[model samples]
Target: MRFIIDVLLTGLAIFLAALILPDSAVSIAGFGWAILAGLIIGFVNATIGTVLRFFTFPLNLLTLGLISFIITVLMVQLTSYFMGSKFDVANFWWAAVFAIIVALIELLLNSIFGSKDRD
Candidate 1:
Protein backbone atom coordinates (compact mmCIF):
# COMPACT_ATOMS: atom_id res chain seq x y z
CA MET A 1 0.00 0.00 0.00
CA ARG A 2 1.00 3.64 -0.29
CA PHE A 3 1.23 4.07 3.47
CA ILE A 4 3.69 1.21 3.85
CA ILE A 5 5.81 2.53 1.03
CA ASP A 6 5.79 5.98 2.61
CA VAL A 7 6.95 4.53 5.90
CA LEU A 8 9.82 2.72 4.24
CA LEU A 9 10.76 5.86 2.35
CA THR A 10 10.58 7.90 5.51
CA GLY A 11 12.81 5.38 7.27
CA LEU A 12 15.32 5.52 4.48
CA ALA A 13 15.25 9.32 4.54
CA ILE A 14 15.81 9.46 8.28
CA PHE A 15 18.66 6.97 8.04
CA LEU A 16 20.22 9.03 5.27
CA ALA A 17 19.73 12.27 7.24
CA ALA A 18 21.40 10.75 10.30
CA LEU A 19 24.43 10.00 8.20
CA ILE A 20 24.62 13.59 6.90
CA LEU A 21 23.93 15.35 10.19
CA PRO A 22 26.44 15.58 13.00
CA ASP A 23 26.16 13.45 16.15
CA SER A 24 25.14 16.53 18.10
CA ALA A 25 22.22 17.07 15.78
CA VAL A 26 20.51 13.71 15.94
CA SER A 27 21.40 10.20 17.04
CA ILE A 28 19.82 6.77 16.62
CA ALA A 29 20.70 3.42 18.06
CA GLY A 30 20.73 1.80 14.62
CA PHE A 31 18.86 1.24 11.40
CA GLY A 32 16.21 -0.96 13.05
CA TRP A 33 15.34 1.74 15.50
CA ALA A 34 15.36 4.36 12.76
CA ILE A 35 12.84 2.40 10.72
CA LEU A 36 10.62 1.88 13.73
CA ALA A 37 10.79 5.55 14.61
CA GLY A 38 10.08 6.44 11.00
CA LEU A 39 6.73 4.66 11.17
CA ILE A 40 5.83 6.61 14.27
CA ILE A 41 6.95 9.86 12.67
CA GLY A 42 4.84 9.17 9.62
CA PHE A 43 1.78 8.46 11.71
CA VAL A 44 2.26 11.61 13.75
CA ASN A 45 2.70 13.64 10.61
CA ALA A 46 -0.47 12.27 9.10
CA THR A 47 -2.60 12.90 12.20
CA ILE A 48 -1.24 15.61 14.42
CA GLY A 49 0.72 17.23 11.63
CA THR A 50 -2.37 17.80 9.54
CA VAL A 51 -4.28 19.36 12.42
CA LEU A 52 -1.37 21.52 13.41
CA ARG A 53 -1.03 22.86 9.93
CA PHE A 54 -4.70 23.68 9.78
CA PHE A 55 -4.79 25.42 13.14
CA THR A 56 -1.62 27.34 12.49
CA PHE A 57 -2.76 28.69 9.18
CA PRO A 58 -2.45 32.23 10.46
CA LEU A 59 1.17 31.78 11.45
CA ASN A 60 1.89 30.13 8.13
CA LEU A 61 0.49 33.13 6.36
CA LEU A 62 2.19 35.67 8.60
CA THR A 63 5.52 33.93 8.29
CA LEU A 64 5.10 33.43 4.57
CA GLY A 65 4.89 29.67 5.14
CA LEU A 66 8.27 29.36 6.80
CA ILE A 67 6.47 28.15 9.90
CA SER A 68 6.41 24.74 8.24
CA PHE A 69 9.95 24.13 9.45
CA ILE A 70 8.78 24.64 13.00
CA ILE A 71 6.01 22.14 12.48
CA THR A 72 8.54 19.64 11.17
CA VAL A 73 10.75 20.22 14.21
CA LEU A 74 7.83 19.57 16.51
CA MET A 75 6.94 16.39 14.64
CA VAL A 76 10.50 15.10 14.77
CA GLN A 77 10.81 15.98 18.45
CA LEU A 78 7.55 14.23 19.14
CA THR A 79 8.91 11.14 17.41
CA SER A 80 12.02 11.29 19.56
CA TYR A 81 9.90 11.59 22.69
CA PHE A 82 7.70 8.68 21.71
CA MET A 83 10.59 6.43 20.74
CA GLY A 84 12.78 7.32 23.74
CA SER A 85 16.36 6.09 23.33
CA LYS A 86 15.69 4.67 19.93
CA PHE A 87 15.88 8.22 18.59
CA ASP A 88 17.41 11.36 20.00
CA VAL A 89 17.41 14.94 18.72
CA ALA A 90 19.53 17.22 20.89
CA ASN A 91 18.71 20.47 19.16
CA PHE A 92 15.49 21.80 17.72
CA TRP A 93 17.46 23.49 14.97
CA TRP A 94 18.90 20.14 14.03
CA ALA A 95 15.41 18.68 13.97
CA ALA A 96 14.43 21.51 11.63
CA VAL A 97 17.35 20.78 9.35
CA PHE A 98 16.75 17.05 9.50
CA ALA A 99 13.10 17.56 8.70
CA ILE A 100 14.02 19.66 5.66
CA ILE A 101 16.42 17.06 4.36
CA VAL A 102 13.98 14.22 4.90
CA ALA A 103 11.22 16.12 3.15
CA LEU A 104 13.43 16.91 0.17
CA ILE A 105 14.62 13.32 -0.13
CA GLU A 106 11.11 11.93 0.13
CA LEU A 107 9.85 14.43 -2.42
CA LEU A 108 12.57 13.43 -4.85
CA LEU A 109 12.00 9.73 -4.29
CA ASN A 110 8.24 10.06 -4.67
CA SER A 111 8.65 11.92 -7.93
CA ILE A 112 11.21 9.51 -9.33
CA PHE A 113 9.28 6.36 -8.33
CA GLY A 114 5.87 7.79 -9.29
CA SER A 115 3.16 8.67 -6.79
CA LYS A 116 -0.45 7.76 -7.32
CA ASP A 117 -1.52 10.69 -5.18
CA ARG A 118 0.23 13.18 -7.41
CA ASP A 119 -1.36 14.54 -10.55
Candidate 2:
Protein backbone atom coordinates (compact mmCIF):
# COMPACT_ATOMS: atom_id res chain seq x y z
CA MET A 1 0.00 0.00 0.00
CA ARG A 2 0.96 3.64 -0.44
CA PHE A 3 0.98 4.19 3.29
CA ILE A 4 3.44 1.39 3.86
CA ILE A 5 5.80 2.70 1.19
CA ASP A 6 5.68 6.17 2.68
CA VAL A 7 6.41 4.82 6.18
CA LEU A 8 9.34 2.80 4.87
CA LEU A 9 10.78 5.84 3.17
CA THR A 10 10.36 7.89 6.32
CA GLY A 11 11.99 5.23 8.50
CA LEU A 12 14.92 5.09 6.13
CA ALA A 13 15.16 8.85 6.28
CA ILE A 14 15.09 8.84 10.08
CA PHE A 15 17.67 6.07 10.21
CA LEU A 16 19.96 8.05 7.94
CA ALA A 17 19.41 11.15 10.05
CA ALA A 18 20.38 9.20 13.14
CA LEU A 19 23.53 7.95 11.42
CA ILE A 20 24.62 11.33 10.12
CA LEU A 21 23.87 13.33 13.25
CA PRO A 22 26.41 12.52 15.90
CA ASP A 23 24.17 13.54 18.75
CA SER A 24 21.07 11.78 17.55
CA ALA A 25 20.39 8.25 18.76
CA VAL A 26 17.82 5.64 17.87
CA SER A 27 16.65 2.83 20.11
CA ILE A 28 16.78 -0.75 18.87
CA ALA A 29 13.35 -1.78 20.06
CA GLY A 30 12.43 -3.05 16.61
CA PHE A 31 11.05 -1.94 13.25
CA GLY A 32 7.66 -1.23 14.79
CA TRP A 33 8.70 1.90 16.62
CA ALA A 34 10.58 3.16 13.61
CA ILE A 35 7.54 2.61 11.46
CA LEU A 36 5.36 4.31 14.04
CA ALA A 37 7.70 7.26 14.18
CA GLY A 38 7.66 7.41 10.42
CA LEU A 39 3.88 7.41 10.36
CA ILE A 40 3.71 10.17 12.92
CA ILE A 41 6.33 12.16 10.99
CA GLY A 42 4.47 11.75 7.72
CA PHE A 43 1.22 12.79 9.32
CA VAL A 44 2.82 15.85 10.88
CA ASN A 45 4.41 16.81 7.58
CA ALA A 46 1.21 16.33 5.68
CA THR A 47 -0.85 18.38 8.08
CA ILE A 48 1.30 20.78 10.09
CA GLY A 49 4.01 21.16 7.48
CA THR A 50 1.59 22.09 4.76
CA VAL A 51 0.00 24.80 6.86
CA LEU A 52 3.35 26.18 7.92
CA ARG A 53 4.61 26.22 4.36
CA PHE A 54 1.55 28.08 3.18
CA PHE A 55 1.91 30.69 5.87
CA THR A 56 5.61 31.11 5.19
CA PHE A 57 5.36 31.26 1.43
CA PRO A 58 6.69 34.79 1.28
CA LEU A 59 9.66 33.97 3.48
CA ASN A 60 10.27 30.84 1.45
CA LEU A 61 10.33 32.85 -1.74
CA LEU A 62 12.66 35.44 -0.29
CA THR A 63 15.08 32.92 1.17
CA LEU A 64 14.83 30.42 -1.69
CA GLY A 65 15.93 26.92 -0.64
CA LEU A 66 17.20 28.08 2.73
CA ILE A 67 13.68 27.95 4.05
CA SER A 68 13.61 24.29 3.15
CA PHE A 69 16.45 23.60 5.58
CA ILE A 70 14.55 25.36 8.33
CA ILE A 71 11.47 23.39 7.41
CA THR A 72 13.44 20.18 7.71
CA VAL A 73 14.69 21.15 11.14
CA LEU A 74 11.16 21.88 12.23
CA MET A 75 10.06 18.55 10.88
CA VAL A 76 12.81 16.83 12.80
CA GLN A 77 11.79 18.58 15.97
CA LEU A 78 8.21 17.63 15.35
CA THR A 79 9.17 14.02 14.87
CA SER A 80 11.00 14.03 18.15
CA TYR A 81 8.05 15.57 19.91
CA PHE A 82 5.55 13.14 18.46
CA MET A 83 7.67 10.10 19.15
CA GLY A 84 8.36 11.26 22.71
CA SER A 85 12.04 10.90 22.06
CA LYS A 86 14.97 13.22 21.84
CA PHE A 87 16.97 13.99 18.72
CA ASP A 88 20.00 15.60 20.22
CA VAL A 89 21.74 17.58 17.55
CA ALA A 90 24.75 19.72 18.40
CA ASN A 91 22.94 22.72 17.06
CA PHE A 92 21.04 23.98 14.07
CA TRP A 93 24.08 23.29 11.93
CA TRP A 94 24.06 19.62 12.87
CA ALA A 95 20.34 19.48 12.41
CA ALA A 96 20.81 20.91 8.93
CA VAL A 97 23.47 18.35 8.14
CA PHE A 98 21.29 15.52 9.38
CA ALA A 99 18.32 16.82 7.42
CA ILE A 100 20.29 16.94 4.19
CA ILE A 101 21.61 13.46 4.71
CA VAL A 102 18.14 12.14 5.41
CA ALA A 103 16.77 13.83 2.33
CA LEU A 104 19.46 12.31 0.14
CA ILE A 105 18.87 8.84 1.54
CA GLU A 106 15.12 9.12 1.11
CA LEU A 107 15.54 10.32 -2.45
CA LEU A 108 17.83 7.43 -3.28
CA LEU A 109 15.38 4.92 -1.82
CA ASN A 110 12.45 6.49 -3.61
CA SER A 111 14.33 6.35 -6.88
CA ILE A 112 15.24 2.70 -6.42
CA PHE A 113 11.69 1.83 -5.45
CA GLY A 114 10.29 3.80 -8.39
CA SER A 115 8.52 5.95 -5.80
CA LYS A 116 5.35 5.33 -3.78
CA ASP A 117 3.10 5.89 -6.77
CA ARG A 118 3.43 2.27 -7.75
CA ASP A 119 2.29 1.03 -4.34
Candidate 3:
Protein backbone atom coordinates (compact mmCIF):
# COMPACT_ATOMS: atom_id res chain seq x y z
CA MET A 1 0.00 0.00 0.00
CA ARG A 2 0.93 3.66 -0.16
CA PHE A 3 1.83 3.85 3.52
CA ILE A 4 4.17 0.89 3.24
CA ILE A 5 5.86 2.39 0.21
CA ASP A 6 6.32 5.69 2.03
CA VAL A 7 7.86 3.93 5.03
CA LEU A 8 10.22 1.98 2.79
CA LEU A 9 11.25 5.12 0.96
CA THR A 10 11.84 6.95 4.21
CA GLY A 11 13.90 4.00 5.44
CA LEU A 12 15.97 4.08 2.28
CA ALA A 13 16.51 7.79 2.77
CA ILE A 14 17.62 7.27 6.37
CA PHE A 15 19.99 4.49 5.38
CA LEU A 16 21.42 6.62 2.60
CA ALA A 17 21.84 9.56 4.98
CA ALA A 18 23.77 7.37 7.41
CA LEU A 19 26.01 6.15 4.63
CA ILE A 20 26.59 9.67 3.40
CA LEU A 21 27.67 10.99 6.80
CA PRO A 22 30.87 10.21 8.70
CA ASP A 23 30.64 7.34 11.19
CA SER A 24 30.92 9.72 14.11
CA ALA A 25 28.24 11.97 12.69
CA VAL A 26 25.55 9.41 12.10
CA SER A 27 25.38 5.62 12.03
CA ILE A 28 22.72 2.96 11.76
CA ALA A 29 23.03 -0.75 12.35
CA GLY A 30 21.60 -1.72 8.96
CA PHE A 31 18.68 -1.28 6.59
CA GLY A 32 16.29 -3.18 8.83
CA TRP A 33 17.07 -0.98 11.81
CA ALA A 34 16.82 2.02 9.54
CA ILE A 35 13.28 1.00 8.61
CA LEU A 36 12.21 0.81 12.22
CA ALA A 37 13.96 4.09 12.93
CA GLY A 38 12.08 5.65 10.04
CA LEU A 39 8.80 4.48 11.49
CA ILE A 40 9.64 5.91 14.89
CA ILE A 41 10.73 9.15 13.29
CA GLY A 42 7.41 9.42 11.52
CA PHE A 43 5.50 8.76 14.70
CA VAL A 44 7.47 11.23 16.74
CA ASN A 45 7.20 13.86 14.06
CA ALA A 46 3.50 13.30 13.76
CA THR A 47 2.75 13.40 17.46
CA ILE A 48 5.29 15.36 19.52
CA GLY A 49 6.65 17.29 16.56
CA THR A 50 3.24 18.65 15.70
CA VAL A 51 2.63 19.95 19.18
CA LEU A 52 6.05 21.54 19.40
CA ARG A 53 5.64 23.24 16.05
CA PHE A 54 2.24 24.58 17.01
CA PHE A 55 3.55 26.02 20.24
CA THR A 56 6.59 27.48 18.55
CA PHE A 57 4.69 29.08 15.72
CA PRO A 58 5.42 32.54 17.13
CA LEU A 59 9.15 31.85 17.17
CA ASN A 60 8.88 30.31 13.74
CA LEU A 61 7.37 33.55 12.46
CA LEU A 62 9.94 35.76 14.17
CA THR A 63 12.86 33.63 13.00
CA LEU A 64 11.55 33.50 9.43
CA GLY A 65 10.96 29.76 9.77
CA LEU A 66 14.33 28.97 11.33
CA ILE A 67 12.57 27.51 14.33
CA SER A 68 10.97 24.92 12.07
CA PHE A 69 14.41 23.71 11.06
CA ILE A 70 15.45 23.49 14.71
CA ILE A 71 12.35 21.48 15.45
CA THR A 72 13.31 19.08 12.66
CA VAL A 73 16.80 18.67 14.09
CA LEU A 74 15.30 17.96 17.49
CA MET A 75 13.07 15.39 15.88
CA VAL A 76 16.16 13.65 14.51
CA GLN A 77 17.75 13.66 17.93
CA LEU A 78 14.60 12.23 19.44
CA THR A 79 14.56 9.52 16.80
CA SER A 80 18.16 8.66 17.59
CA TYR A 81 17.30 8.41 21.25
CA PHE A 82 14.40 6.09 20.51
CA MET A 83 16.58 3.94 18.27
CA GLY A 84 19.32 3.71 20.90
CA SER A 85 22.62 2.42 19.46
CA LYS A 86 20.99 1.30 16.26
CA PHE A 87 20.74 4.89 15.11
CA ASP A 88 23.27 7.28 16.53
CA VAL A 89 23.81 11.01 16.02
CA ALA A 90 26.91 12.58 17.46
CA ASN A 91 25.77 16.09 18.37
CA PHE A 92 23.39 18.94 17.60
CA TRP A 93 25.30 20.04 14.54
CA TRP A 94 25.59 16.47 13.31
CA ALA A 95 21.90 15.92 13.89
CA ALA A 96 21.17 19.04 11.87
CA VAL A 97 23.38 17.77 9.06
CA PHE A 98 21.77 14.34 9.18
CA ALA A 99 18.31 15.90 9.06
CA ILE A 100 19.23 17.94 6.00
CA ILE A 101 20.62 14.89 4.23
CA VAL A 102 17.60 12.75 5.04
CA ALA A 103 15.24 15.48 3.89
CA LEU A 104 17.05 15.92 0.60
CA ILE A 105 17.17 12.20 -0.07
CA GLU A 106 13.57 11.71 0.95
CA LEU A 107 12.45 14.54 -1.30
CA LEU A 108 14.29 13.00 -4.24
CA LEU A 109 13.01 9.50 -3.60
CA ASN A 110 9.43 10.61 -3.06
CA SER A 111 9.41 12.68 -6.23
CA ILE A 112 10.63 9.69 -8.19
CA PHE A 113 8.65 6.82 -6.62
CA GLY A 114 5.87 8.35 -4.59
CA SER A 115 2.24 7.72 -5.47
CA LYS A 116 0.75 10.00 -8.07
CA ASP A 117 -1.99 11.08 -5.71
CA ARG A 118 0.55 12.65 -3.42
CA ASP A 119 1.65 14.95 -6.19
Using TM-score as the measure, the top candidate is: 3
Candidate 1 TM-score versus the reference: 0.84
- Between the candidate structures 1 and 2, which one is better when assessed by lDDT? 1
Q: How high a TM-score does candidate 3 get?
A: 0.93
lDDT against true structure, model 1: 0.83
Lowest summed lDDT window (length 10), candidate 3: 110-119
lDDT per residue for candidate 2 within 19-81, as digits (tens), equals: 555544433134566566667666777888888888888999999957756876777666766
Q: Tens digits of per-residue lDDT for model 3 on 40-82?
A: 8888888998999999999999999899899888988999988
Worst 10 residues of 1 by lDDT: 110-119
Superposition error at 32 for model 2 (Å)? 2.6
> How many angstroms is residue 8 displaced in model 3 relative to the true structure, after the best TM-score fit?
0.2
Compute the lDDT of residue 94 as modeled in candidate 1: 84
Worst 10 residues of 2 by lDDT: 21-30
Each model's TM-score? 0.84, 0.75, 0.93
Candidate 2 Cα deviation (angstroms), residue 5: 2.2
Candidate 1 residue spans exceeding 4 A from truth? 116-119
